[model samples]
Target: NVAVILAGGVGSRAGFSRPKQLVKLGGLPVVAHTIKRFQSHPLIDEICIVSTADHLEEIERLASSLKAHKVKKVLGGGTERRDSSLAAIAAYEHEALSGPLYLIFHDAVRPLVSDEVIDRVINALRHYNAVDVAIPCADTVVSIDQVTNEIISIPDRRSLRLGQTPQAFLHDTISTAYAAALRDPPRAHTDDCGVVLHYLPSEKICVVEGDTYNHKLTYPTDLLILEKFLQSNGGRRKVADTGDRQLTQLRGKSIAIFGGTSGIGEKMAELGERFGAKVSIGSRRNGVDISHAPSVQEFLKEVVATHGKLDAVVNSAAVLTYQPLEALSDEDIVSSVGTNYLGALHVARAAYPYLRESRGHLLFFASSSYTFGRAHYSVYTSSKAAIVNLTQALADEWDGADVKVNCVNPDRTATPMRTRAFGHEPQDQLLDAQTVALDALSVLVGETTGCIFDVERR
Candidate 1:
């Protein structure tokens, strides 16, 4: 798959002396940030930048810095937006990319576009020949006549949607559609979806739900909002801990600690407090059962109600049951899965609203058992594996919400549960609770979400 980033816009709407795409955003060019999203995406194999001849060298300089993908070509765009699309298609053909290649066209101004959005568009290409990204209109859309500036026929507001990029398609299909559309006078459309719809009316362009946070940089005020977003996330990215405990990244932040009553969880709460976080606990001992959705919901609600702000939620609640699969009772199985897997869901579902409001972090704990399927603990390991997948899935689902999701997989920890399960692993061979707690907090502060961070083994 390849991404074609269009930077040919004249920046007429933006009063800046230079082009809007070239404008510095969070210490990088707006286009650089836009390029980074695709460059870092695992699926993207190559990139093509389309711009005016004057800006090609500068964009090449910036693209060189991001060695994430092979920049196959940097070509000059046509006078119109459609012209750039043509140039990209021609270059793609010149490269002789294999039959039915996938192409994603994104605007350089929309720097915050997430990998989830790009992935969804590419996934949709499997079934749909052409696809577009759009979000439901929050405000009622009105139709007005431009001639007299009078109210015209009002379409159903419920059906209206605001479109965004990157609009994607099968390289051959969209290029064919564009080839047919270019025969007539240039059509005034903002996106390729219109080009396909107008020329290839028979083909249906699938619409994927896009994120609100993926706002394009058009107006001057948008620069201020993006700048603030950068600062909040800690300078162009999240605050990743570099084993520097003295930094105290969580200072003044409020965090909810599920399963915070004993062992590792208790130590985590204590460390959070020590690191300057206002920590709240959710555990069975505190009248909050993670397996029960309602209890988890109310626990977080109360935490936010008391603290007045919630920055993160760490769900370290899991039962380490050491029993063969056949030997485990039905009730025991249900309890383990519910607490280990569904418990994470309960916290995520319950905390989404508040987390999204604050753009907070959601951290779930997985055990070392997840990687090496320990025979006696089949159910426990399986549930922990599910937690890892859930963390990634939820991260993608909530990309627009900006609520980061991650899983921390720790080795055998010196906790009551470890002693209860395996009697006694030597103290030297067991990871101390404090070490695991700090590593988990590192995940919370880091900008890299949707990861399975493994704590160092003793």
Candidate 2:
């Protein structure tokens, strides 16, 4: 499949000197980031960025600056979006694109778009001839007259969808649709899917649930929110260590161990390495700033690039609480949730591509206290409970994807965090961290998800 990026529009709303797509989100140009994602996709065969004739020089410079090598051609866009799309179609035909070509059209302004979404669009296009990525309207939608303030129609919000790019199509189907549009053009629409809907039947148009995080950058104020998002979700390139050893049993497979440098995570890495699977480890000590979403995102991309495939993931990293609720600051809660709950979510999202590719297993480290309800461990327990709930929800949602999601609830593991929570206790009641690690690994090694393994040596 070949991907085409629409970078023609001058985003006047963003108030930049040029198009908003060229604006920087983090360090790279927003369009550059979008292009890199498709470039990184294993299934995508080629990439072409369609920009304005005036912007072609700048876009070429931007691509070179970002080291975007997968982009085979950089062409000029048309007067309108339809024209811009036709320009891309012409470019594909010029190349004599052979075989069953799948075409994906993306908005360059949406920098946060994930590889998972791109894969979904590709998978959809393979089976169905045409599809669009969209989010169902969340708020009550009303259509009002431009002349009068009165409501013209109360549209069913459930049926209404906020269209987004990368809208995908069979190359021939879209080419046909565009050619037909040129004969008797309809009113201008933002997406090619809208153009197709005019000429094609309703059954031909399909909508895939779009991630709300895949937002388009349109305003200056959005930068701050995006920055915060980048920070919390893990940045542009965060590294994960996939323990891949040639002599290991699962040598060809890939497994991820969160906080693998220490505690149960370290033990899991050892086992995974011995099992012959590539293990991806996330550690704060390794310069991974999960507090920043962009950093986390970057780390995940690094892990995927390193392993080339991901077969399993076990989040053995977590924070323990010591302060009372009254004494705890917002910083404390942020640190705990950022590492224990949200950090896991970020890793999961980042590792999604590998899991989808491998149809692998996902394991979370929860706590018995989360379910048993212990005192003075409010924040820690709360975070674990969130993981448990998330594991359940993700498992339910991943029914179509064939990936397994589950968690391990350990009662008391003697790790550094446990020492911080209990203060140098020489108690035999605590279970060995390695023991918990093996139990979690067993669940992943097998095929089980949405189940929490309670490990308490009582």
Candidate 3:
């Protein structure tokens, strides 16, 4: 893969003394920062900078000052943006270059393209054969006649996506598109995607959601906003001294599911194990009893001793009641609440210290009835609701300690409890317990720390 940065733009509109690409942002030249970003990427074989004839030498000097690697300078200054872009494309097609490679065309003015976004675009191009990064247009737009300057019609912005770069393409796909454009270029076309869509089939173009901060530095005022964004996100976007582009990999991350024998708990364990996590499956048959407090505590201790650390704990084991309000005696309420609500609390509390050590996550399972009160399940619903509040309170206390507490309120899942509540059916397409558990697992692994996720997996 190769990254082509179009740094040949003249900042006439911005009225800056220097080219916009050379404008200092966050104490570094904007194009220098942009090249530095991709220079370290493992997938990016080389980084080529297309600068105007006047600024080529200065751009190379700026790169040298930054100690940027994997950079090659190309002399280019065109009357139009498309011409400069084509020059970069030509450098990508040189006889010395590799054939059928993935090429990413990015604007040097947009210096906020993080390593994560670059990796994502590369991954998409590898998978889909062609892809473009874009953000959905958030404003209403009107189409006007060019001659009369009169509004013709209001276009639906909901279906419109504002294109951003690095627009990824196959070496052949982009090479062919630009070759055709040079032969008979369209007067109204602006971006590379426009050329591709005009010449290539519609199915050839694919869109990926782009970051909102990835805006082109078109005007003078925009540079100030870009600088501010860089200052705020400097810690996250700054290139490492080693120039390694690999972000934090999820290897050796141990996620132990307490009560991972069946239902949602079992599904979560399977996923944890699948994602290269050291999964410790706990079940009564395996001598990890969920009913008795002492036995449960001892089992948890064993897990902690074995793993030496825990990354996440998902407590999906719960007891349910199906009796009507009148038929639900105090014993029924006590049994249901003690096992479902108290069991969650016990597991979370027992794992709190271990979780704090690793900044682990604690996930609880609640029923959708906790939100929508249903008939004949008052005791179960109330018990689950208590778990929700427990999660909130625990999250509040553990906020500063780096421990996350969250709950999943699943609806009508195809589990043993669902059969007890809704009874047997010929063919009821209820939510898949595994799907719900996996979705909740993803949430637990993500940055959404404290919240109740109402999941319905159909």
Steric collisions counted per model? 0, 37, 0
Measured against the true structure, the TM-scores of the candidates, in listed sequence, are: 0.56, 0.60, 0.51
Candidate 2 has what TM-score?
Answer: 0.60
Clashing pairs in 1: none
> 137-169, model 3: which lDDT tens digit per residue?
889899999999999999989999888898888
Name the best candidate (by lDDT).
1
Q: lDDT (0-100) at residue 401 of candidate 1? A: 75
Candidate 2 per-residue lDDT, tens place, 271-375, comes to 777766777777778877555567667766787789776777777778888777778889888888888888888878876777888898888878767754567
**Candidate with more favorable, higher lDDT: 1 or 3:** 1
Query: In order, what is each prediction's RMSD in angstroms?
Result: 18.8, 12.1, 12.5
Tell me model 2's lDDT, rounded to 2 decimals. 0.75
